[model samples]
Target: MTHRPRSSARRGDHSHGDVHLHGHGHAHGHDHPGHSHPTGVRGVLHGIFVPHSHDAADSIDDAMEAHSQGIRAVKVSLVLMLVTTVVQAVIVAFSGSVALLADTVHNLSDALTAVPLWIAFVLSRRVATRRYTYGFNRAEDLAGLFIVLMIALSAVVAAVEAIDRMVSPRPMENIGWVIAAGVVGFLGNEAVAVYRIRVGRRIGSAALVADGIHARTDGFTSLAVVAGGIGVLLGFPLADPIVGLLISAMIAVLLVGTVRSVGRRLMDGVEPELVDRAERALGEVIGIDSVDRVRMRWIGHRLHGDALVRTSATTLVDADRLASTAEETVRQRLPNLDEIAVRVVAVGS
Candidate 1:
């Protein structure tokens, strides 16, 4: 019979013969799980008028803050898109521009895209219950799925409108109004696109970033509308429907990219650089034998990870300290880390 050596440090109670390390005095409760700014003039203005911008270079401290940033971006973008759509709709009625009508519909869809994401972020704040041990972080990913679907639907609608216009050519009226409305759509969508993408990257939200890309596609289509209006002014009557078809084709291409991105996130894909960062941070810790494995994934904009490490056979107390230090190192190096589990393995069994 073979016997494994147990040090005096391991004499005390243990679970599965592995030391699980956690930071001392660390709070286990959800941070910013259900937080909101006080309702008043400030909150309303912040929610509507002021654009909330975030920098990708900055580190996010907690999950609640991350979710708030995403919500803020979505809210502001939604408002801007709604206003753009209203203006375009008015023009569409007067000018009878099929291209402008399609752009307006797409812009309205983009505005509504914020709703699912907002709900997802809000749901993410719900405390973990018995039925949901992981909390509601996955809601964000689910919302991402909705965003992809909306993008697909918009493409289909645009294509159909374009095809209908092509089959029965109608004289487009009020070319000036169409051009102005197209300009307005371009500006609105472009602003939302930049804002959403910046905040999304800052908060580590793949879904928000995907939506931002979606808005950027709309902006380009709006520009195409402008081109079509010019073509009409130059006496090319087919220009309106032709540009609409081009816009539809471009949207289809974007849908492919959006699917891959959202699908990857849903499948628990993460950037390789984060794994490298974890290994590097663990390696730099004192008394670590080797970092065997590091796995990380995004739950909403929050990051969670598990790491396995090997260390020299030592007192259980020392092993615990080594593990704790590793956890701290990782927390300091990585942004938006909600929780990290470190398992310590003794060297040579």
Candidate 2:
């Protein structure tokens, strides 16, 4: 939120592996290894395309990659949502259960949220003008907020439907079809899981990975509701309302968790893991006597940070080398870093 740089403001500023194979493995603390530092025109293309490199931790750059990754993810999720929603609606109609109907409605919103995010991704790619120095890095954040809002509203509706069903239990019909539909939805959820994990790792996006986790959990929750439907048809008719209550509780929990997550991102709460890794990386930078202190956080999927470093109190030329070397080293550590800065601190007070 603080503008740490300006036209003349020389104010200092501040992943992949197995992402190719499976749910882009957990973002390791290790920096990117074996990156081909491009030169001449290659460097420009590198800077333009790779998104991160030595000193590539600019805010706009981080946002750009996230915007691009968000688009790909939205498209994949959109198709999956559409496919699952149709199945859910058909099964819910045949089953005569509001719980299933509500689930169908919730699935439909996934597609709705993706559309706007896709648009934001497109808009975010534009070059920043004099008017906007950050070049729309916040676009993904806005789009992210929208997706979180949709999740909240869908949970609310799901909860309300569950309450209605609990009030007047409907004799569920076509139990087999409900179970079949739930199975289909669970499959779709796995598909989402696969896509999100793979792409998230490739791009190093925690948000997309989180989305995958949400989808995976939603599948089980839907399955639980389907089990209730089947049980109702098999004689324990009260099971329908009982599972409905459970689904309501699950929805409420998911809603709260999702909102809290998005709020944290928007409000700028740094992740502890990133902070720890940053501290270690800063310590490793060549010529850096000590890191002194580090402040790192997420901007979308991209990481941006500033470090107040205590050097050995070398000369001016040595100081610049120390600062740049430290910055570049930390930059290499985080493949998705958009901006990273190291401020020289004299050892003495």
Candidate 3:
């Protein structure tokens, strides 16, 4: 049922060290022939220090490490947002500031959003089994969808609260407390935003990055609350609701970008720049005549690629050299490149 390459049929005689490669099947101890692999002490040292490994156990270790880093970011942000919400809730009780209440509610919801991502990261660490060959990596993306939904829901809640305040204006108490709470909200959200965005980008997680953006938006909304308080001080009774409405509008606008970003990842879209980088790396290999195709995608924060390369090499040995070289080149050039499948085709074939 499977078609074998003509070159593979002739590769039955090919051997790497003492292991012979069977016809039409490339299965071997090593990923490629003539590839110099770490042995004994060097392999152990590389595994301990570098953390990246070609072995299954080592790969799982790396995956766990990546997930732990993401979880740390979420935990820290969750704590900060919770503290901010609690402080604002206390101020709301004394101030009766509808604008402050709306922001506080949004902050609470934002803090809860981290829970799903935390669980997703945990689920993503599960080992691949027969039923789920790709493992649970896509759990992160699904969690991202949930985050986007939560953000949209927050926008709607903010809108409804704003509209209600506009229709029936109420006297807000402890205006100074409302101002102080706004400043506190802004500081907390901003700090979490900076940390989340930095960690998210480092781990290459679209979900985490979107959550970071959401936190940044929350920071701006907190600023809007401050502006509303100032407007009330300036004798504009409707300013509180108006600013809340503006905050909702800003969130709605940002939702579109997050949707597009998360949707692309769910659909297996890889950045063009990453593909270009792969192609360039493959092209640099001495025996590779041309890079025919390069396809890459992310599974969680890890990257995998498949490339077809045309080689000018006249013999099987030269072709093996091309394949090995291309693998090494991409591994060196790309960050978090988990694995790559390179197909070697003879020139003009």
Local distance difference test scores for all models: 0.71, 0.58, 0.70
Cα lDDT tens digits for candidate 2, 1-349? 1112212111122111111111101122224312234466544432332234232232223444556666778797878878888877877777777656756776676546667656756765666567865555456567667766655555565566667777876766567777777787777876875676456545544455446545655665566667776787678877766675665565555545445556776787665656666777678866667766776555555555666666664465566556556655665456555565556655663
For model 1, where is the 10-residue window of minimal lDDT? 25-34
Residue 232 in candidate 3 has what lDDT? 91
lDDT by residue (tens digit), candidate 1, 15-100: 12234432121111122111123245444432332234436557466667777888888899999999989988988888787756
- Ranked candidates (lDDT, high to low): 1, 3, 2
TM-score of each prediction = 0.81, 0.72, 0.79
Return the candidate ranking by TM-score, descending: 1, 3, 2
Identify the runs in model 3 with alpha carbons over 4 angstroms from their true place: 1-62, 93-102
Name every residue pair that clashes in candidate 1: 9-316
**92: Cα error in model 3, Å:** 3.7
Clashing pairs in 3: none
lDDT of 3 by residue, 144-249 (tens): 8998887787678778878998998887667788889989998998888778766776667779877877787778767777888899999997898899898788
lDDT agreement of model 2 with the native = 0.58
Q: In order, how many clashes per candidate?
A: 1, 9, 0
Model 2 weakest lDDT span, ten residues long? 16-25
* Candidate 3, residue 345: how far the Cα is off, in Å: 1.3
**Model 1 misplacement above 4 A:** 1-54, 92-106
